[model samples]
Every structure is written in C-alpha cells, then in structure tokens.
Target: MTGNHNAAPTTQNSAADIEMEPFTPHRHEQCRRFQIVSASGLSYEIFVSIPRQAPPPEGFPVLYLLDANADFALADQVLERLSRRPEATGVAPAILVGIGYPETEGYNQPRRHFDLTAGPTRDPFYAKTALTFGGQSAFIAFLQDRLKPLIRSRFPADSRRETILGHSLGGYFVATLATAKPDLFSGYIAISPSIWWDRDGLLASLAVPSPSRPQTIRLYLAAGSQEGETATGEQNAGTQTSAHDALRQRRRMIGNVRDLAERCKAVCRDAVDLRLDIIADEDHSSIFVACLPKALRFTLPFSSAD
Candidate 1:
C-alpha cells in the first residue's frame, strides 16, 4: 500500500517506538494526542484518534490497548472505515488509544514475550535478541492502574466500555488478561493467540473462574484457516519464514482458538458471549486485518446498551 504522505504526520512524541507514523489516512479532525508513562520505568509510547467533528461522547466506547506499535496504523484504518458504516457494527465514532512500542528496528517481530508472555523462560525465538521479553504482567498493570485512568480523565469512556485487541503473542496477552482480570475490560478480541506459549499455561488458566459480574462480557476469537497446514506436509520452525509455514501457523493457532472458545462456552457459557471465526485462506499476518471489522463489530456493537 502506498503511504499517505498527505495525511497528518505522527509526531515523534514519545520514547517508545523510535518513530511512529499514521498507518492510515487521517481525514477526521477531533484527533487527540497521548503520552506514555509506565511505572516500571520501561519507556513506551501511545496515541489516540477520534472523530473529526464531535467532541467525544461521555462514556464512549474506546479500544484501549494495542500491541505491535507498527501495526497501529492498520488498525486505525480499519476502525476509520468501519465506524462510518451504519450496517456494519453501527458503533458510533469513538477514540482509539493505540499503545505503541519503544523499538526502532525489526518492528514486525515484537519483544512480545516481554510485553505479553507471563513466565520467565527464555524462548529460543527471542533469546538474547535486541528486543527484550517478559513485561506483559507489568504492561497490564500499567494499562489497568495507570494508562486507562489517565485516558478516562480526558475522554468520555465507560468504566466497562473497553476492548483489548492483540495479534499473535499480543493475542496470548489478551486471553491471559481476560481470565486473570475479567472485570478490567468489557471485551476482548484475540487474533491467532500464541497458544504454544508456556505449554498453553495461559489457556489453562482460563479454565478457572473469575469473580462473577453483573453482566456478560463479549469475546471474539478468530484465526486464519491456513495456520497448521503448509504446501508441504510437515511442521518445522525453520520454515516459519516461508509463506507455507506462515499458513501452517494460522491453522494451528485457529485450532487452539477453537479449543479456547469451547472452553469459554463450557465455563462461562451463560456469563460470556464467545464467538469464534475461522477465516478461510488467510495467514497470521493478514488475519488481523481481515478479521478486524468483523471482530470489532461483534465485540463492540453500535447499538445502545439499553
């Protein structure tokens, strides 16, 4: 896709991601700015975009946390397009608080183990890499305790009008967060979670119950159908970079999502709204883009809560 050079440029405001750019066209006017202040002293950066016309509504629904700073623009684009569609989610114009990373190089491969993973083992995938691992627990604390309150102070966000969306390891983070503190956010959209993490420790944790809530929260889980199978018949880490391996990962991840969805149905059947979508022929990288509108529509409906 051609870069929208004419669109409003993203300021290099925070020390989080070395540089941040608007991944989507910014036609709207009510754009707002944000800064990062993590208690862990871990430097991070984030931004928020809103409708061009109206002041944000009180108790407005907002997408809270986003992983992979580089991917924020794509999400913003998706939201910008979908929010205009009356038939789609019917969701009103709202703010998108995109939490970005603090890295400048190799942005696609996130130090997600640090930002998303729960435990302390150095997985070979990210061991001794320039990017660090294992900050997710703190990250969540940052969101729940600090960043969120800061956003609420400025915008009209409902106490329960938040949705956390993540991809890959980020997906793993959302699932872990949902089960660990279900009340913290109102909805969850996990795309192709890394179910392989810690031998599915996060997935297993979801089996346990959280304190019951007065109302049910919604969850939308989607995976690409191409995750597990490749043009070749086998699975190997060496092939991860291959287009084929990418396809396989989606399949494998989707299977894991299905299992989790089933588990959600079994455990919080009546208390939660769980929907699993398997997109045909899409791979991991494309799944989030392909699934975003539907995911957002399903999780955060435009209709009034009344």
Candidate 2:
C-alpha cells in the first residue's frame, strides 16, 4: 500500500488530550528544609526537625543522619514518637538533621560512594564498576566547616551532645569519622557498616590511636543475625562451593562489623562507651529499621538520675 510519508501515524489513543495534575505544595510540618552550599561548591539538601517540646537547659542534642533522602522519614518519626514518651524509651527530644544531596532520589550513588568510602577499593568486583571512592575527607570537611556552623547558627544545638547515624556505606563513613576525628561527634551509631570496604582500610586505620581523640565518646555498633548468612544457612559462606561473590561479600560485612566492634572496645576501653548489638533474623537491608529505635535511645538517654 502506498502511504504519505509526511502524515502522522494513527494510534489507539490521542496524545494531545492527556493532562497532568497541577503541582501542589506538600511539606512535612515537623521538618524544615535548607539548601546549603559547601566550600567546595557541592550543594546539599538538609532537612532539620526540631523537637516539639522545649529545649533542655543545655540546648537540644542534634542527630546528624547520613543518606538523609532515604532515612529521614523513619528517623524523624522514631525520634519524635519516642522522645514524647522518654519514661519508656529513655530517648529525649532532640534536633534531627538529615544530610542529603540536592537533586536525587534515595541516594546519589556516585556521590555516596565517593563521599562515604575511606579509601579506594581493592575488590576486583568493585574495581570493574565505574563508581569512585575516597572523597570522605572532603565530605567530612564540608560537614565540619560548613554544615555544623549553619545548623548551630539557626538552632539551639548542644555541641557536646552531637550524634551521627549512618548505615551501609554511610555507616562506613561514620566509623571513618569516629576513628579519624573522634571529637567531631559525641556519639556514633554504625548500622551494618560496610567495614569490608577498601580492604578493611578503616579498621586498619583505627588500629592506631586517632590523632584527635575524645576523652568520652559513645559508640553503638550493630549487625543483623542474617547479615552474612546464605540461603543454605551458611554464615560467611566464602567461595567454597558456589561462585557467588555476594555470599562472600555478605560474610565479610558481618565479620567486619563484629571485628570493628571488638576492636573499638579493646582500643578505647577506658574512654569509649561501646555497645554492640545483633538484631535477630534481620539482614543488611532490614537491620537499620529494626535497630534505629535502640540506637536512638542509646544516643539520647534520659537523665534518670536527675
């Protein structure tokens, strides 16, 4: 059949009639958003949630959450609800700040990889991927130099009560921060931290005394019961039978977390209030939600003696 080449093709439906919903402003009442530019010109979307109750005499404790785009909702809800009933959970009201990228979904993968890892990975598998690593120092500088001051200027944040929460690579960053700059935050929560990164570089670094050590610091470490467990129930199931790299990776993750916790206790026995927890039946992905409540409680304990 001869056809006109310039004519528009016929379709089951017309495209011109479709209409999109008008944009509406939907904001979280408890949260305030801020666009902060770091010294290096990286823009961050920071979401801060102040406590509903009045600040304590010393000012409110601040929880600095990593991977904020993904974790802020859960962390904010948990803190808000638990803080309201401190008698039960022993978690007091505090300021919650989520540090996230400017225009991204749950995570800006490349940025996260670069900003979270302590050093470049030697893993053959990861080496094949295009992802970069070893921007953690710069990211920490941004936090210390720009973000903290911005938050302090706007909120009544208690510098002595600052806490940091991170999971997976974020968790790795938290551990790196703790060892490299112990005095940056008073409390550190590492949930299923990627301790297997960069040939366990972070753990190796922590072996020696940190140049900047805090006299008194609280460290909470946690891993899931099934963190490194295989479908066949083998833990740390290295490449013995199958060639699945994930199994060995998972094993490394679980082992590293435990090892890091023990090392922290041994190294900072006198100065660090280290707590290790393993949530049963939870794996790498599920452990954070399950353990966040406990972590928050530990970080913001009520002054029962008072």
Candidate 3:
C-alpha cells in the first residue's frame, strides 16, 4: 500500500462507499504488513508471512529476513512451499518477518549501506563514491530491542529456534552480528556477504572468544562461484592482471566466506557448526535467488536425531 499511510482510506467515485489499501494480497499466504517507528523514530515497513498451518506445540521457528523489499517475497514463497513437504525437504514451516524501509520498492541502497555496514571506512575504490556507512549496531539494536520482541509477543515464535537470513550487505550485517551478539539467534544464513567490509575487524573478531554464545551456532555461508569482486588472478598466460581487479578481488566473496567458515571452525569448531555453499552459474546479483531454496533448507535444517 503506497500512500500517506497515516491518513484514513479514501475513495474518488461519487457513489463509492469505501476504498481499501492498494496492496494485491497474496492468494495462498497468510501475509500482512504494517508500518512501525523505532525508538529513534525511524519508520519501517514490516512484512510478515505466516504459515498457513497451525504452529507446533513448541511454536513455529521464526526466520528474520533483511533486505525485505527485495528478498521477502522469495523467502515467503520458497519457505512456504518447501515447508509443505518437510518430511522430504527437511524445511519446517516458520514465520518469515522481513525488515524493510518505508517508501521503497526494491533495495533502498542508501539506507542499506548505512544500516548493514560496520564502519565509516571503505575500500580505496569506494573512496571516490563517498559512501557513508556504519549503522549495523543501531540496526541490530532495533532488531533485538524492538522487532524481535514485537513478533514474539504477537506470534507463536519459537524462542530457541530463531534465525537470521540476508544477502550481500544484509549478509554482512548478520556476519558482523554473530561476533557481537552470537547468541541473538540460533542460526545465520549469510549469502554472498560482503566480507570485505571489515574496516573495523568484525570478521576477525569471530575467532575471539565471547563471554556468551548461542545454545547452537549454525552458520550457513553461501555465495556464487563467480562472486569474485574482480579478476581473481593473472590472465592470458602470464599477462599481468589489472591492478584494480587484483585489488578488488581481495574481497573474494566466495573465498572470504569459506575463509570465514574456516576461521570460525578453527576456534569454535564444536560450538559452532558451519556450512558453506558455492552455487554454480550465479553471480552476486542472481546468487541469492539460486540459493534461496538451499538457504531455506539450512534455515530449518533436518535433524538426523529427530
């Protein structure tokens, strides 16, 4: 629904008695949306997709999705479908809550850059872009202090089975969150995370022991096979790779995520079970779509013991 959300509904026909919000409602999903303002008075569009089935006794697990304006529909659809055949797919039905900005259609790039990153710094290449950053902490605060509680209060959310899912910068946000608040969610799905966004050493700090930890730390890091920010190595039989390309590939979206998994494994092996996926034939833009199904599998993983 796109209008003055604070205002009452309206109609233009002289004989019309009522008018409804403009949303084309989903036919099969119990989905709804509303506007919320945070303690800081930042208004957000909260998109929710609830399971059609009743919750389990312990309650349905909740998977919180970032970059909702872009990925929420995908998550909502894939999660609902796979969940229908959980016995085979191993993806249980769960509540999918998308956090997104008001007054945006797709990615609100400016808001995301600030909301998902951890530092005001950037790679030299970005120096010319003059991009501002470093709002992950405040964003996490909104999730922890307000959003999560609101969802739990209103839904049958499984407290012990909460998970976070994101892509790219959103992925970066969750990756950084694991180090600072490892116990905030039971699991994380960071697809093609911009691991290079380490100006403040968020990735490095993963190896550092935290005083607290999640009861179970399952980190699923996925990226496309072609996610290198630039050419990975020398080209054309010893021809020197472009300096800029060489410099840019350092982000090594796939390599860095693998490296991240390895680093966390080395330090928290038993405590943190990690999985990394390099999906074939996808780049950063298409990678998340290709991986969404598998991502859902990870979000509500099958338990062998079960």
Runs with alpha carbons beyond 4 Å of true place in candidate 3: 1-25, 207-214, 229-248, 302-306
Which has the higher TM-score value, candidate number 1 or candidate number 3? 3
lDDT of 3 by residue, 121-160 (tens): 5566677774567666767887888788878877788888
Clashes of each: 20, 0, 0
Best by lDDT: 2
Ranking by lDDT: 2, 3, 1
Residue 145 displacement in candidate 3 (angstroms) = 0.7
> lDDT score of model 3?
0.74
Cα-based RMSD of candidate 3: 6.8
What lDDT score belongs to each candidate, Candidate 1 first? 0.66, 0.75, 0.74
The sequence of per-residue lDDT tens digits that candidate 1 reaches over residues 1-306 is: 011112243442234432334433356545544445566654455677765434444566788646636676677777777777535556555568877654432243444456676665434554566554566777788888777877777666766678889888778778887766777787888888876665357656764335566677878888887675552223343443575455455336767788888877887777678888898878777788888888878776776431
Clashing pairs in 3: none
Task: State the TM-score for model 2.
Answer: 0.83
Candidate 2: which pairs clash? none
What's the CA RMSD of model 1 in angstroms? Answer: 7.2
**Comparison by lDDT, 1 against 2, better one:** 2
**Which 10 successive residues of model 2 have the least lDDT summed?**
16-25
